[model samples]
Target chain A: MERTRKPQQERAKKTVEAIIEAGFMFISRQSKETLTTTKVADIAGVSVGTLYEYFGNKEEILDAMYARFSEDVTAMLREVTPEVIRKTPDQGILHILQHLREMLSRDNQRYLHCAALLSQNLPEQHVAPIRQVLATLSLQYLSRNPEYINLPNLPVMNYIMTHGGIAALVHQLSSDDPMVTFDELSQGLATMARHMIEGSRRDAEQANP
Target chain B: MERTRKPQQERAKKTVEAIIEAGFMFISRQSKETLTTTKVADIAGVSVGTLYEYFGNKEEILDAMYARFSEDVTAMLREVTPEVIRKTPDQGILHILQHLREMLSRDNQRYLHCAALLSQNLPEQHVAPIRQVLATLSLQYLSRNPEYINLPNLPVMNYIMTHGGIAALVHQLSSDDPMVTFDELSQGLATMARHMIEGSRRDAEQANP
Candidate 1:
């Protein structure tokens, strides 16, 4: 019975991993328009019916990939502790940037392309989980030390934190400049956050009236 | 002979315009993945040979559409002069935002979708002409009157004048908040500019030593 259950578990794991690898492969060549169960099955070296047994359709596979990707990103953010962020906002932002760059580099361009496609195509849905992670991380650090940042509207700050950071990341990934190293990308994030903090105080003052 | 030439000229003009419109329609629904010459010809109510006679392939049709669409945007920008930019950057940004909204609104969403698809699939050769037009227009207004602003680095300043301005416009376009009006978009641009300018100055001072 133990041996029977072991085969079943291994088969399920292999099937799920194959579906996700196929999904990434499909997105790399084309944007959201080219995704299909048949294409994924063909790429994954599996029968279309077997693929359907694992996923209802392309959207289900994509949704699963999104959930898995978000979990990975969140895990990276969690590795940067509150103590690390307490040192400075710059350090926090740089740490996150380096972590993202390392993760993207490990896949040799697939992760970067997938991240850009998701951000562009499914902004509303895909942004939510990432935004939640950023908000939790941002608030945890900022609330403990109001000296670094003081603002009236927390939601707007959250918006800037998530969108501005992601925008900088996406720009670096999509740029054709091979000489633009990851250090510059990290510095860009630090610059973005510092600018946001410095400006938000004045905006808060003006909005109060 | 003169009369014959006039009629032939008119027919050629109609065929070119019809092909462009059909390309837009095809991109609006299916995107660049499903783009095909036969489908474009069918939609344009022209023969496949006629389509080929006018342009080489789908890229040629896309090039024509991009040139025309970019000119439309330039014309809209020219409608707002340096004087408008001087009165208030926020007001100027608002005027341009509303103009773009109106321009895309006329097509009832088809143009916006087609434009987004084209942006994704644009050929490398098409970038230079568009950049030249944008840079010439942007420098004509923003660079001529530097006393009105205080950004430190000229290159970064020029970059902000182009990328930051466009980013603000795109953010507003993609926003789901119905309550977020053009005025809010303008204010956002102004806010982005104000912060980045300060940050640039800080970087400049650090670089000088």
Candidate 2:
């Protein structure tokens, strides 16, 4: 019984992954309007009956795709964010931005499509964990750095920074002609962050002196 | 017939406003899914026939509300953003943030509801105009201000600033326990901008020195 159930579960998991992959591929090449059960099944090389057993409707398929997109994106960030916790603010932002863009654009069309899909039907739940991971990691960064810890309203500032950074990235991806380099965009943000840190340090010194 | 048509148009305009107001109010208190045309008519004190004349469905009413929200918000920013063009970066951010918060909080719940509605169904057309306005206004500011003109990729910086600002505000509003004061939020962003300007000026001077 154990051997039979394990093989069946593995097959079910593979089928689900194939269907999600097919749906994602379909949206990339065609308008989302043209997607249907039969098309997805055909692309996935599965029968409609098998598709129905897993997904109740098209939206359920979309939900599955969205879930996978967010999970993969954040997991990538989680692995990379902590590595930069010890870097200066500008360098830290630069590293994360570089890593994220490189990884996403590794499959450029897939990344853009998933990003467009999430933006069109974005859920607050998906955003919360990403920001939280960012905030938590940065909080660790701050506690370790003696100088920046002096900046007033550090928690609030961290909130603004993470949220603002996330916002800027999303805007860039969704904008027309989003062909700019992460180098240029990251420079703008990194420059902004570097100055804030310097100014804060100056203010702290002036107050103490 | 001509005389009757004029009053009919005026009366039609008034009825449409009333229905939109009622629909707006309903969404503020209840879930959007719970809204029905009959309920909107009942709340507006009009017959369902009158509501139907202007709106084909709930989504149409939502579109109308979104149009009004973006128009009014951008209009308010247009009036106020220019007033800060000559001011320093921090001061400019402060004034705009102050004015926006004061005006919106004057009708806080309505503002929140409208913002939520728009965020939930935000169209690119609506966002494009606001960013354009922001970029246009800041381009004027940069042209007028000698120091910031040296910044490489001024257009890109403007794009980042405006989109980042808009996104941050939306995130703030939609955030759980969003009772933060504008002063604090503005300070963080203002500091970031101020330093970027100063840094660019320093870099330019050093390059030519």
Candidate 3:
């Protein structure tokens, strides 16, 4: 009985994963008027009864995807090295953006929902979207901690963080042979952020002097 | 025949324009399996034969739309003030980006094809797409002329020009009330480019010393 239950458990895990993956693929394609349970199950290659066993509805499946992504982003943000950023922020920004690119570069269908949210929410300018939470937090950190990076040009930072940061990541990660690699992309963004910091420094000096 | 011909010509122009507009709307919505002549005529409130009067087929309809948009963009680019860029490149970049935003901000279905190209081409990382011709030209200009905003970080410039420039414009223009106004977006991008210029100037000084 225990051995038989193990196969059932493995099958159940596979079913849930397939359902979530299908959720992103559907959202990405935007193929239908309304994404019904039957449609999702068909894409997932599972029966409607099996889908019902796991998820009550389509929204719950999407919510699960969101939850998984949010947790991953939260964990990623938590892993930032203070020493690296404090010592040399140019490299720090580079490291952070590279880290971002890595997480995005997974190229898995799971986070297609996040990319979908990112692409969708950006046009709507939903400033507090989950994906932008990192950029938003970075801005807050800049305001709080002058030692790391003191930037008065929050608007510019805000623009680049969303457009330059996320757009580059998404575009680069989506393609097989990208125009800019993650390393090059990271270095370039670091250059961008680092230079902006220099400009801010000049501004501070000009005001005080 | 002269008075009768005038009204007939005006109506003909109107019909052609409607068909083009409907073509963009259908492409934008992507609701159907195949974009047939019948579907386009339905959207245009005309018969399929009427659409054929303006164009041969769906491809011709899209091509006409592309041609019109390309000409408009060409005209806009030709109106650039050389003196403005030569004198104050920071302001020059701001002015140019503002000009670009104005052209994009029309919110007309007429140029929705270009916006669609901008959005669709970005994901696949089509480096030399028509939408990026402006950014590409900007980089080429930088390489050719050191007098105006010279920077050795071509990689960074290329990355930001496409992602920062085009993606920001498309996103900002698509929305009704964008978070970053044309002024704000242009100002932010100018700040971004200007700071990098300052950083480059420092690099030049250090290298010379």
Question: What are the Cα lDDT values of the candidates?
Answer: 0.64, 0.73, 0.64
Tens digit of per-residue lDDT, candidate 3, span B1-209: 22122225778989888887887788767722357889999999999877776675566776655665655665565566453435355676676766665775576643543464444323322333444555655655555565745457766666765566766766666555567776777777777777777887787778886
Tell me the tens digit of each residue's lDDT in model 2 across A133-171. 777778778777766787855655566667667777776
User: Tens digits of per-residue lDDT for model 3 on A1-209?
Assistant: 22122225777889888988887778677733357888889999999888887876655776666666656655666577443335355776676666665675466644543464544323322333544666655655555566745457666566666666766766665555677777777777777777787887787789986
What TM-score would each prediction reach against the true structure?
Answer: 0.68, 0.85, 0.67
Q: What is the TM-score of chain B in candidate 2?
A: 0.85
lDDT of 3 at B24: 72
Clashing pairs in 1: none
Looking at model 1, give its docking quality level: incorrect
Each model's fnat? 0.09, 0.49, 0.49
Docking class of 3: acceptable
Ranking by TM-score: 2, 1, 3
The 10 consecutive residues of candidate 1 chain B with the worst lDDT sum are: B1-10
Please give the lDDT score at residue B123 for candidate 2.
72
Identify the superior model by DockQ, candidate 1 or candidate 3: 3
